[model samples]
Target: MEIKAKQLDSVNASAHIKIPSQELKNEVQNLAKKASKTLKIDGFRPGHVPVAVILKRYEKQLQNDAEQNLLKNALNNALKELKKDSKELVGEPYFEKFDKKDEEIDIEFILSFKPDLKLDDYEKYIPQYSEPKATKKEMDEKRKELLKTHASLEPIKGKRALKEGDFAKFDFEGFIDGKSFEGGKANDYVLEIGSKQFIPGFEEGMIGLKIGEEKDLNLSFPKEYPAQHLAGKEVVFKVKLHEIEELKIPELNEELLKKILPNEKEPNAELLEEKIEEQIKNEKLLKLVDEELKAKFADALIENYNFDLPKGIVEQETDMQFRSAWQNFSEEEKKELSQNREKAKEKRDSFKEEAQKSVKLTFIIDGLAKLRKIDINDQELIQAIYFEAYRNGINPKEHFENYKRQGALPAVKMALIEQKLFNDIFFFSKTNKKGEK
Candidate 1:
């Protein structure tokens, strides 16, 4: 037997093992001797069968069993030589070579270990920003929006022009630099004035325009607009008003109050208002660190911390992401990629960067969770799964079994850890900043 092991990087190792043919034969004989004691061949008495006869009867099975034992022994020896515990290993160590040669069986295995993340002062990665707060005016607007949810749109009876808080349907075409742009035109688009869903100054620009009125409104997209081409660009929208309507909100009386708060103790208009305020405040708090903020925080953390990732783990993530994207690709795309190996590789490689980031964040989150002692116990995890299942009208036991079968429980746990870790960071960081308990 010969063994050689080397750490390739911080998180990966390589091992080469060799076993001579004579040694392999000796192992096979050992297994045969053990099996001979328990042999039950019709021609042989139990515990009295000859080793030669046993080998003859189960030559292939004995050899395979011996080979498996040898593989385990080889890995154990290699790990001992490397001064590493098998418990510290990441995913399975895969064989790069397991070929039988003239004199020996050669084996090469690549092992990946979890990286040691020194996450000192990691709280510096959290992005600093003011939390969103609900103003009285905004609260009133929320109350009105809630009212509109249960309201009906009624056409105006009189010849009234469009005004603030009025709903209008109109045709419009937008031009940029004297040329029309994509998504810059609409036909009979219904809009509520002061809703502020469109470009800034757009709804307000439509104010005072009457039915059958034709006008042109100049506007500019916000500087932080998602569309890069149209961001902060001046544009002209030629508009023609078609009709006007108003949201006929139901009266906030006893009947509507009961409908809004059926289970409340003595439901009333005051109770509804209080519920609306609470709902609006809760929404503002939940959305305080929105997607954009989370993304920016992730970016900052990735930039701040640098570490080497396990190559095998990254490859696994990249493969998974690529396969997920491939399933969503149109049939034509699949066919195109299938015919061109290079294009297929390029498409797969496109996910590598993102996979690397995802793996890094996973490690970072793990380290943070450890630092904060954040955890989701088995019972908590079970309760979460059950709650989610019930919310979605799924059988809790069935959902749990499905997750177990798909090997997704770890992913769920990790997500929960990440969520709790961030929540702790945000809450404590904000409270400390405010000098509050």
Candidate 2:
């Protein structure tokens, strides 16, 4: 093992790591020896396979494992030689190159760590403002809306033509050029007139039709419709309006309270009002506090913590942003830009400033979290992911694994950490200042 490393700066380093052929071969053999004890293969008894057979049969996998093992070893040795603790490391060490030749393996790695930020007193950035309060009138309005959501659907008292916001019970049969299509007919389907649940033109076509009135709506399926065969094809739906309906809003009494808040020990108007007030207060607090004060404070902190960012990371961010913008360009635009090198450089250069700021803010946040001892553990992160998955109706394990595979788990964890850090800061400050005159 030979490692030649140089410090690029206080927080960045570069190294050339090497492992001779003999060591790699020895590692592969060791791996094969371990695999022989646990592997099961055809024509061989479990835990009794020969190491030679295992090496020959799983050569690619063994080679990969061996390389990974050596890389880890190289990292540990490099850390020791550099006099840098593993705890101070930041993002994954970037591999500049990994070359495997007949006699040896060569690797180039660029390592970085959290900079020693001399951040100023960030508390001064916290904006001073009167905390927002939920008014009684607002709570009363919200409560009325909540009770209306629990309202029952009832037949309309006065018969009238269908209109936007009205609900309709109708029967519809669809046809393509006089021939009926599969899944083209339904009976007694209840739909909100302007909900847009149906294809475009279908809901609008239902307007102005009275109960018992029948009308034929001619439409073309959108080009991107899910049904490939029907996409961009013309169809006509013969719809007959059967009933008109409206929401019969209920009184916020005991019966309605029980329906809305089942299992509540005290399902009364007072309890409902309290819950409503909490909801309104939270909404206002987010708008007034998080958006206004917290955002302003973050910008101020970024300006206050003036420090140099890692150049490699900043360039990487700029490149990523430029490539993303390129992907969104129209093909003609891409062609024009590709033909004009100077113009393309200008396009890419526009992203550099923002990219620098973004990279710098990330490091600033990282240092601030360390200084404040604000941290997010693996369990807390996974719980947040699980809650998001539940809300979006996805399997939590699958979502986690998907994020892990895409190498996006770090970004997600960072986002959670940022949210946690900001919330923790604003919360305590607000609590301490609660009794201020």
lDDT per residue as tens, model 2, 1-437: 89998888877888898899899999999999999999999889999999999988999999999999999989888888889988988767888789998999989988776678765476666666666567878977897789778888888877678889888999999999899999989999999989899889999999999999999999998999888999999999999999999877787677888887888987988887778887786677667665676677667777777765665687678888999888789999899999999998898889999897888888877777877788889998899989999998899999999989988887898888888777677665554244322
Query: In model 2, where is the ten-residue run with the lowest total lDDT?
Result: 428-437
lDDT of each: 0.86, 0.84
C-alpha TM-score for every candidate: 0.62, 0.69
Measured by lDDT, the strongest candidate is: 1
Summarize candidate 1's per-residue lDDT along 1-437 as a digit string, tens digits.
Answer: 99999989988889999999898999999999999998788887899899999998899998899899998898889899889999988877767788998799999988889999888877666666655556889878887877877899999988877898899999999999999999989998999899889998888888888889999989998999988999999999999999999989987778777777879879977777787777776566457655554677678878888877887788788889999999899999999999999999999999999999999999988998898899999998999999999998899999999999999999999998888877677665553233212
Misplaced by over 4 Å in model 1 are 39-64, 100-103, 137-279, 330-347, 431-437
Clashing pairs in 1: none
Model 1, residue 123: distance off in Å is 2.0
The candidate scoring highest on TM-score is 2
